[model samples]
Each structure stands twice: as C-alpha cells, then as structure tokens.
Target: MIKERLISLDVFRGVTILFMIIVNNPGSWSFIYPPLKHADWNGCTPADLVFPFFIFIMGTAIPFAMPAKTFDNAAFNKIIVRSLRIFCLGLFLNFFSKIELFSLEGIPLLFGRLAITFGVSYALMGNFSLKVKTYLALSIFGILLFLAFSGIEEYREVRIPGVLQRIGIVYFFVSLLYLKTTQKTQLLTASVLLLVYWGIMALVPVPGIGTANFEINTNLAAWLDNELLPGHLWVYTKTWDPEGILSTIPAIASGISGLLIGQLLNRSLPQLEIIKKMVIGGLTITVLGIVWSTIFPINKSLWTSSYVLYTSGLAILCLTVLYYVIDVANYKRWSTLFLIWGVNPMIVFFFSGIIPKVLRMIEFKNPEITAKTINLQDYFYSSCIAPFFNNPMSASLVFAILNVILWSFILWLFYKNKLIFKV
Candidate 1:
C-alpha cells in the first residue's frame, strides 16, 4: 500500500487554490471575462468549482490526518484543536478590516473570536481531566455572550457565514462520519444525503412562494436562508446565501465523493488499476450528474446534488491524470511549483485576501489630479497594463494573473523554509 500522501492531490489542490485567488481578486469585476465570473444565478462556471474543490480536498485529507484508530483521547484532542484553530482564524479574517487597533474591540475581537472557537471545540472534545482547557473554553464562551448583548453596533453583518467557517463545519461532520462508518456505509450515507436534499428542494412547498422552484430568490434554499439567517445573509444577496444552511447538504455530498475516491486510492491496488478505476468511475458519475441535472439543475450557488456529482467527477478525473503523470511516471519536476501552494493553502488563501485589501487601503494622491486619490493596486494596473492592452478585460486578466505569480513566489518561500501553516 502507498504510505505517503499523493503528490497529485497536492498539485490538484494547488491548481484549485491558484484559480480561487485569481477569480476572487480580478482587477475589476466589471472587466472580468465571462468564464471568470460566476454564472449570474444558476449553472456552473470555472469560478464555481473552486470552493467545492477545496472542500473536496479537505475530505481527501481526513484519512491521512485521522487514521483508522478508535476515537481515542489523542484523536479527539487533535480534531478539536485543529477545528478551533481553523474556525477562529476565519472569524479573525472577517473582523480584520473593521476593528480599531487602540480600541478595546480591535485586537481583542480577533483574540476573542479565537478564544471562543477554541473553547467551544475543547469543551466538545470530552473532559480528559484537563481543567485548564475547560476553564479557558468557558471563559471564552462567557466573553462571547457578553459581547453579543453589549450592543456596540458594528457595521459588520450579524450572521456572516464565512467560507472558512462553512469549510470547518462541513469538515467536522464529514470527518466524524468517516471515522464512524465503513466505506460501504459511507457511500450509502452520501447517496441518501444527496437524494434527501433533492427530495426537499423538488417536493417540499416554499411557503407563500407556492411550489418548489429553482428561481433566484424563490427557491427552497433561499427561503431557508431568509427565514433562518435573516440579517446574516450574504451582503451581496440579503435574501439568500450561496453558502447557506440548506445547500450544505449537497456540499457535504461533494466532500464524501472525494472521500470515497481518496479511500479508493489508499487501497492495496496497482497504480494503473487505481487510475483506470478513477477514470471510468468519474465518467460514469459525470454522465449520471448530467441526467440528474435535467430535473435538479447543476446550480453551484444552490449546491444542487447534480452539481456535487459533476464537480466531484471532474475532480477525480483531474487527479487521476495528475497522479498517473506526476506520481506513477516519476514526472515530479513540475510538481514543486504546485506543491508550494498546495502545502501552504491556508497561508496563501489568508494572505491573498489580506494583501489586496492592504494595497487598496494605501491610497496615493493622484498624479493627474491633486485632490483625487487612487488605490495602489489600481495605480499599478492602470499604469502598468491598462494602457498597453486596449481591452480592460485583458488588463484585468493580467492583474489577476500577476497576483497569482506574486503569491506563487511567496508560497515558494514557505515551501523552501518548510513553513506549512496547518489548521
């Protein structure tokens, strides 16, 4: 059996993370290519595949991280610590721009979020005669409760469902599911989850909206977000959340699909046999997804069941090719480039978000107009590329690609230094 982590998995994840940064930080949303932008509402795009791909990658990593031992104290402790660390980091990212440094709320808010997430996760991990962990967790919880009722009235949204938070939550459940079940049972559970989600969206009536539908704000998923989340929905769509509650069911399915493939890869089989199975299985799943989409629709925002299968299928196919070429055939020279981002995904993702915001914040007095100020990034783009390219779209693409190159260099340093930032 292969004892090491797959080089192809890391490369696949690196490729996914690279696209994620590019799509997310385009020079101008207005000037983005059609494929770079998310589909207006329903349907999938290259942009739509990144988040689920990350989630799928998370699923594949679980077995390597947790192993097949019973949920012992060590295992429990590891899961809680890692989940809290990741979740708190996410909360801090959401609060980074809004808080004031000297004010009580600034750095403390960041620490407080970390403490709260850590404490909650610790408490859930079972008491192992560790009073310090328990007390710390309680203290964090108490601080959060006080802050909730303090009525400080910040500009941030009430219930911001962050990308990292969703990943953490889905990861927790799916990883736990894998630990508790056999492979056969896991596959069945995933199928049931996808089917149940389909039934709910297709059969259940949306109150006041009448029948179940896939329309923009009229769908079951949107209604659940509006009703359950209320003021916490995505700022872009106050009425609905792309990573909303109801849609998470299918998202979990995407993770399970990856987990299934990961388990397959781990089996005692020849390399060519593994790759052949993945290619054939992926094509079959892809065809089934297409047929199901006739009724359910492969919507990325909604995370429809069809979308889960379709994306997972593509992910499997991609990984198969990468594994065969890079791992089996010993073609690993190019793998180093991808391994940089793949090894330090969270670090790349977090800094990618922070750097752009920092650049945008650093405004300079416009050279052309004394009273006007322009963002540093905008100035660089306008001067360096916009004038050269007649199409703003081309310039925007150049800016995004440049960001990727810059981040790739930064990640390469981390890879060289062996500075992977694991949750």
Candidate 2:
C-alpha cells in the first residue's frame, strides 16, 4: 500500500481548529466582530463553517486512516471500540463541569454499580460459583431499578450533545458506511439524505404553525426540537439547538462529501489534473448550493442541505488551494505553525476549552480602587488586551487571536514531545 500523509489536509484541519478556538473563546460575546459570530437563523457565516469543515476533514481522513476495503471481525471490533471510546470521551467532557457527576438514576449507572459491588462481594465470598455471581449481580440490579425510577421527570431538561459528541456520532456512521459501501454508493447516500432532508423541511406541516416554514423558530427543525427534545434544547436557547438531532443528517452528508474527495485523491492521476478537477467540482457544488438556497434558505442552525453543500464546497476549495501550494508547488516553508496545530488537534481543542473554563472559574480580587472580584480570564483580557485597543470589538478580536496564538505554542510543545491524543 502506497500510504502517505497529506500535508495539505493537516494544514486544513489545523486552520479549522484554530478558527474554532478563536470563535469559541471571544474575549466578550457582546463585542464580537460580525464575521466571528454565527448567523442568527437563516444564513451561513465563517463561524458556521468550522464544525462542518472539521466533519469534512474527518470523512476525508478516514480513507487514509483505514486503507482496507473490507472489514473483518477484528476490524469491526476495533471500530466499535474506537467509536465507544470517542463517544465516552465526549460524555466525560460533558460531565466534566456538570453539577451531578454521578447519580444512580439511570440503568447504565445502576448496572455499573452492580458490577463493582458484585466484584467486591465475590472477592470476599472466596471464589464464588458462577451461579452465586449471577444471583448477586441480579440482586444488585434489582435494588438499582427501584432507586432509578423513584425520581422520574417526564422529560429531561439538560442535554449533553457537545461538539465532540456530534463528531463522534458522525465519524462512527460515516466510517462504517465507508467500510460497507463503495464511493459511488456513498455519493448516492449523501444525495438521498440531502434530498430527503430538503423534502422534509419543505413539505412537513408543523403543528400550531399552519404551513411549514423555514423561519428561525417556525422551521421544521426547530419544531422537531420542541416536540422531541423539549427541555433538552441548548441551554442558551432552551428551545432549539444549533447541533440538534435532525440537523445531523445533513452534517453527515457534509462528512460524506469529504469521504468522496478523499477517495478521489486515491486515484492514480496527475497531481495538477487532480487539483484542477477538485477546484471545478467544488465550484459546481457551491453554485448548486447557492441555487438551492433560493428555495431552502441555507441556515447554519438548521444544518440545511444547501448549507452542507456550500460548506463542503468551501472546504474542498480551501483544500485544493492548500494542496496546490504545499503539494504541487512543493512549498513547505511556512506550513510548520499549522502543522503543529494539525498534529495535536484534539488535545488543543480540549485544553482550549478546559483552560478557559478553569480560568473563568478562578476568581481574584480586582486590581482596582473599587472592591470587586473578577475571573482570571476577564482580568487578563481587560488588562492585557482591552486597554490597548480603543474599540471593544477590536479588543475582543485580538483576545481571540491571542487565544489561537497561545494554543499554537502549546500545541507546538506537544508536537515536539510527540504527545498527540487522537480521540
């Protein structure tokens, strides 16, 4: 197998991750530049492209990561374990700062408790029979069931579908799809999903809203969140989520587009010819997406079909530029900064959030005449960044840029140490 790592793809992923860190950790939300902020309801913005671009990178990287055309039992088991690990990591991050770290209110927790208890009890019992272990496990499970249902709400108010969770979910399905089907089939599947989502949004009659519409709160996606998700919407919105369930369908389509591109690159073609074809394909898809938006309206929150195409096309366009510059032209001088970020994308992203959250949680006496307390993050932003810029928006932008620069250095250290975390 002629396997080679694509420097262009790494740079692309690094750039996307960098932008993600910047937009997510603005110095002040209210003072953000318009381009950095997400589109309100029914449009696409640079901020909105980050997530889909990462998804597209995931899909594109899979073919390179797993070069096999078939899945055996061992491969399938590995896939399952990897998916679970990624999903569990996301769940761990979700509960990292939650009020309830562990509660015996769910069956999963109950079973987990039972297993631990049974192991301890069985050790004390001195080599218990299989029959005895079974009885003990069952007894513990029974006790857990009663405690689990004692305080039940009809609907869960909080949901934990973070960015990592969405990435994990999309990665699992798309990776499995790549294993099971050909590139032609993947393209067809993406088309079907996009068309189906478009049809659903256009035709489905949302209750109490009369005819279906694509407006912010009145859209079919928002309606589904209200009916199905209810209290489980985004904490900020409390009604709809940007990365809601139905929207994931098109997000997966975005990933599939990357998968198609990845597979295309595997073909034995001239480098210049491949780059030219990619540019042309990306342009065509982008145009189609813009035309489709006339009817569907490309909304980031909805993860509308047209938005997927547009974002995916943009991703491809960006990738082609990187490929042409770095690969075709053999330009490697200035790619190191992004390459460092690319090597440790997951770790940088995780710590980017964790460090900010930790800093925000740590309060100190305000270094001012008045008696006041402020989080370290706010203090640093005000002292280090805000005073320099007359415009608050410029300060906010600088703060975000500083965050990107800070992470680049941190990731550089990890790259030097070879401490990259993949999942």
Best by lDDT: 1
For each candidate, what is the lDDT? Answer: 0.77, 0.77
- The segments of candidate 2 whose C-alpha lies over 4 angstroms from its true place after superposition are 100-156, 367-372
lDDT of 2 by residue, 1-423 (tens): 424688999999988998898899888999998889999878888999998999999899888888866788766655554454444444334333332325644444435534543343333232345445344434543433333333444223445455766787788889888999988899999999999999998899988887878887887788788787576567788777777888888889998999999887877888888898899989999999999999988988888999999999999999999999998898978999988888777666555655675576567688883498888899999898899989999999888888888888788888899876654
Q: Give the worst 10-residue stretch by lDDT in candidate 2.
A: 117-126
lDDT by residue for model 1 (145-215), tens = 34434555653354456677678677777777777788898889889999999999999999989999988
Model 1 clash tally, residue pairs: 0
lDDT of 1 at 410: 88
Task: Give every collision pair in model 1.
Answer: none
